[model samples]
Target: MRGPEARPRFGLSLRLLALTLVFVLLAEALVFLPAIGRARVVYLEQRLAEAHLALLALEATEDGMVDGDLQRRLLGHAGAVAMTAYQSGFFRLRLGPDMPPRVDAAYDLREVGLWPPVGDALMVLTRSQPRLIRVAGISPKDPRVAVEVTLPEAPLRRDLMRFARRLLGLSLIVSLIAGAVVYFSLARLLLKPLSRLVAAMRRFEAAPEDPGRLHTPSTARHEVGEAERTLARMQARVREGLIEHARLAGVGAAVARINHDLKGILTTARLESDRLEAQTRDRDPDLARTTEGIAQALDRAVALCAATLSYAGSELPSARPRRLAAHHELTLAAQRLHQAHPEIAVNLDCAVDTTLSADPDLLARSLDNLTHNAAQAGARHLTLAAHTSNHQTTLTIADDGPGLPQRARDNLFQPFAGSARNGGTGLGLPIARELTQAMNGHLNLHQTTPSGTTFHLTLPT
Candidate 1:
């Protein structure tokens, strides 16, 4: 249920500890069970061997077969301290009042071989008698006769049960201690890095720009180091972007102040041109031509000033779709170009019925910047053309001038970069590109050939 950022949320180290503990406990159980059984067997075999040797000694008496007197003497002595001496089963001697009482219910003895010399060749199980180990050997002088001993199993069973409980207790204590030590060691060595990473993230959220906070120190030389470096880089890039946005806001404010006064001057120029056109009409043809040219120049100046002001504005209005004549935007671009370079002649080439959905004012500004750039490259003739392709409309402005310089090509449409010509404010291409994109359109440099340069403006149908 927790997200990735949540701390100590069943991480890699804890999972590894859990898996390792299961295996360790299983292995201990395997060894502990078998080891307790083996210890009980070894002790039982030593006691049985000792009891059988005493019976053999008793057979050495003058009565060569079974010795009742020797048996009674041995039983009285050995049974007194059987449990303490063997730490296993009891010792018993037959043929005495103290010998195991005969039971009406008795079962035949079955020989169950304990591995190697550890236990007797046969043992007895009976409902009315105690469980037993049967030990027997031949008389030293008479091959026909045999000596025998019976050891009760109660003491051995009790001792083995006690030893098993102790062994299990020790194993439990040891495993718990080992698990705790391993857990602490892993928390320090492995989980420590993750803890530092969490603390660093907290600091980053609290006061990201504060240089007073120390960053997480990376000790690992593997992918952890790479992660630390990557986080630092991302923080740096974010900081730089914030600074750039602030700078752009300031620039916008300053341009807005300058545009107010420039608009007033443009208004005065338009009024003067209107008066000149009224006087030169019909009476002097040559003078009227010159007056019209002055009016066109003034109009271009006003439009150029407006475009610069629009660039300084925070946002421009959306394009209003209307019936746009083919030559309207081109005429505006040519008039604006004449204000800066009157010698250049701009020609419009089309089938004359082309139309596009766009804001004429914004499109003219875009084309004016392009034509002015071409003129500055020593272009003597400029061409503006309109065409349609695959449900889209395109406007192209080209010139027979030098191509764009190599240095500015990469960032030609980015802000503050494409100012290779004199009297060029670098924002022109960038603003043009921005406005074009806002209209759901695109502006691209179609070519930079030796004979001329071309720019393409494409708008969706």
Candidate 2:
């Protein structure tokens, strides 16, 4: 009974937002690697340029020398513990003050490659203790030889740390912006529509007959729009089906009441016909024949009323199964049909000698309905054939009358709508089918053409 608002914590929206954030951060990480590497290289290059400029003071002096105080100031200003210049194949120590005892790492800017800086940057970031490192690069103004400098890693590490913090902060901001854009865009385009569809389905399930639950579909020309259109059509069909079912139920109830009255009237008419036949026998042959025909008509009317009531009842009669010869049932139905319509010929061709486990009364009634329909359709010749094959019994009833018209064929098994002849109640085939199904059997129209119509009934052996 979970409602739409009771969606789980890790629902679609949260998952979509999380996925968007992850993808945005991943893209930012790609840019961050090269940016950090470039920053480190630029920081070291600036230090080299400063150290070269500091050496210019020595060149200005008459003896190419500087006082200790001036040298110390220059070294401190250049951010290097030691500075050396390689000019014209001669390496000269230009400045040195409080140099470290050992150099932990060395880097040559001339050997710099696209990817080497990224690896070097990562190495610097991973270090724990500060150590002295040597860096060599050609002076920006004078490219004849290289300027070399020794510096502690602590200052560079601090600068890199500051740059990293800024980059991380910037990446987070960009990721948030991008994630928000993607999440909202997808929610509008897909998630919101999908949520609406789910809610509609839940509401529809609660009360399918309610027309208001069916929403007007979106006109978007995408898959989500198609889904909405399909759902709308399905809901519309379900509503139509429910209406039809309720209408049928009402019809069944009315038919039950009419059938009850009709049966009582037919029974009284049958008794009167019997008395009239007794009085007219032998004294008036024509009058006796007329009374007999009236009795027959009343009998058929009573049977039809009974069958209609059976079908319209809340439930079918429970099956009373017994082993009986299927051919015997067919013969009995044919005999009864022949008695009712003596003008028509009923030919029974039962090749099946096997017996079937079924309700004999229901089976006979179904066959009787089929045969009666055939006789009423002005069929001159009716054929009832029974056969057995593969542990099943099949009974086929065929008639040589005008085949069912288009209207009757369209609703051949629908009560009151499948009447082949005018004034027919159209319940024969439907009752037959219902009864057959109640006994775990099938009734199907085998064939229907201008020449003849055939119905096949199959039952388990």
Candidate 3:
């Protein structure tokens, strides 16, 4: 019965695209942090160098100092309110106002590490208000000289903001590019093929018996290809099984339709044979025995026909379980085997005379089927061994029949298709196993090898 078709709430391709963009942005952040820090350091150094050049203006003057108006102009050009320089402890230069408020924050650019600049850069971006910051660095003109500059943080912050915006814009572009690349790689390689497989499965599920609905596998060498190939093989096998079962169903229907006619013929034969036996009873004693044999054979044929009918209907008579002596039952089974195949030796081994709860008729029929099958398989000797333990009785029927063939082992207990020998019914083991199950027991093909085959039948005791 069909209920509803399925739809993905969130498509896999979309999820892949979203994740690709997110990961790309994360990667850009990693590149941006250190890059922004390095940029900040460069800006500070550039200001210090400009401040150094402005102090050189004082050096140009005869008194190593400049007028107030000229100092203000130099400070404005250097983008710092104050500048100081010291060299060889003799040459000292200071410019701008005497004091530039109280210093708020200080930085040393001479630190030889990445983390410090990164930390300072992050703090600068997150700060709500700007402050006057002092930056000290080695002098660009002379190695022994040291230069320092004090400037408002507002200009530095503005330059950083502009760089960040541009970097973010480029990151967005890169994210789109990366997402597109992933779509081509992951979506086409994985998602598309998986989607095809899902669609094929849905179509097959709708009409499984339709051979045309089978999926066609692609030639890509990947997990998706392997899955497609596996699905293709599975679909082919399931179709074959369904076809085989359909043929079996047709055979069953045909057998059912002919059942009445077959029954009538067997009944007529039995009655005629019985009459012949009665008429020849006193006339010819020897002929009477032959006629009696004919009647008994006809009775067997009729019973076999009934069994066939029941098998075709997939049912069995209700089992009547009762406690029976195990040794006695084994002896009876051995006798039946000997009678059926007089050439075959029948061995009965029951070390302990245990009690078993099983239907006598079902157990007898199952054993007959087993022994008869063994005989057909070239078995000359059969063992009916019984062992009881833990309230369970295990009856093993072993036969030296050159073991079972590969085909028989592969399709063991499969009705109509299990027989290894030509002209065999193939229903013997299946019928016997079904009967054993009806009697609340199990019949298993325990082992088969080149030497012999063992069938284990377990029943409650």
Task: Report residue 450 deviation for candidate 3 (angstroms).
Answer: 9.8
In candidate 2, where is summed lDDT lowest over 10 consecutive residues? 92-101
Ranking by lDDT: 2, 3, 1
Instruction: Kindly list the per-residue Cα lDDT of model 2 for residues 1-461, writing each as its tens digit.
Output: 45455668698999999999999999999999998899999999999999999988888888878889998899999998889888886975478854444688899998888889998888888887878999999887589858998998889989998999999999999999999999999999999999999988988987889989886898999999999999999999999999999998998888788889889999998999999899999799999999998898888788778867766774765788788887788778877887898898888887557677789889988988898898888799998887888888888899998899999999999987999996688998998998999888899998899988999999988
For model 2, what is the error of residue 73's alpha carbon versus the real structure, in angstroms, after optimal superposition?
1.6
Range of the 10 consecutive residues with the lowest summed lDDT in candidate 1 = 117-126
Q: Tell me the spans in candidate 1 whose CA falls farther than 4 Å from its real position.
A: 1-182, 214-237, 260-408, 419-461
Cα lDDT tens digits for candidate 3, 1-461: 68557677877887888888888889998999988899899899899889898988888889888888898899999999899997876649989776555789898888848878888888888886979999998877677878989999989998988888898899889888887997779987888899899988988888889989999998878899999999999999998998898998899888876875788897998888788888989999999999888877767666656766777887565799999888898888888878878899988888756879999999999988998899989998888898888889999999998999989988899976788787565789998998999889999999988887999999999
Model 1 lDDT per residue over 1-461, tens place: 23345555787777868966776678778767566646655554455445445545544656533556665565554431221112123333323344444332221122323342223211211123446544444323333434343455555566666776787788888777777787778687666666666667677666656554436456568665666766666666665676677797888778767776777887797788778778878788788788788777767666656766766665754676555766666777788888889999888886666777777777776777777777777899999888988867898888898778775677798655676664455677787777787777899998887787788988764
Better of 1 and 3 by TM-score: 3
Candidate 2 stretches with Cα past 4 Å from truth are: 1-6, 88-93, 97-101, 245-461
- Using all chains and alpha carbons, the TM-scores for the candidates as numbered come to 0.40, 0.55, 0.62
User: Which of the predicted structures, 2 or 3, would earn the higher lDDT when compared with the native?
Assistant: 2
Quantify all predictions' global Cα lDDT against the true fold.
Answer: 0.64, 0.88, 0.86
Candidate 2, TM-score vs. the true structure?
0.55
Model 3: lDDT of residue 458: 93
How large an RMSD does model 1 have? 15.1
Q: TM-score: which is higher, 2 or 3?
A: 3
Worst 10 residues of 3 by lDDT: 299-308
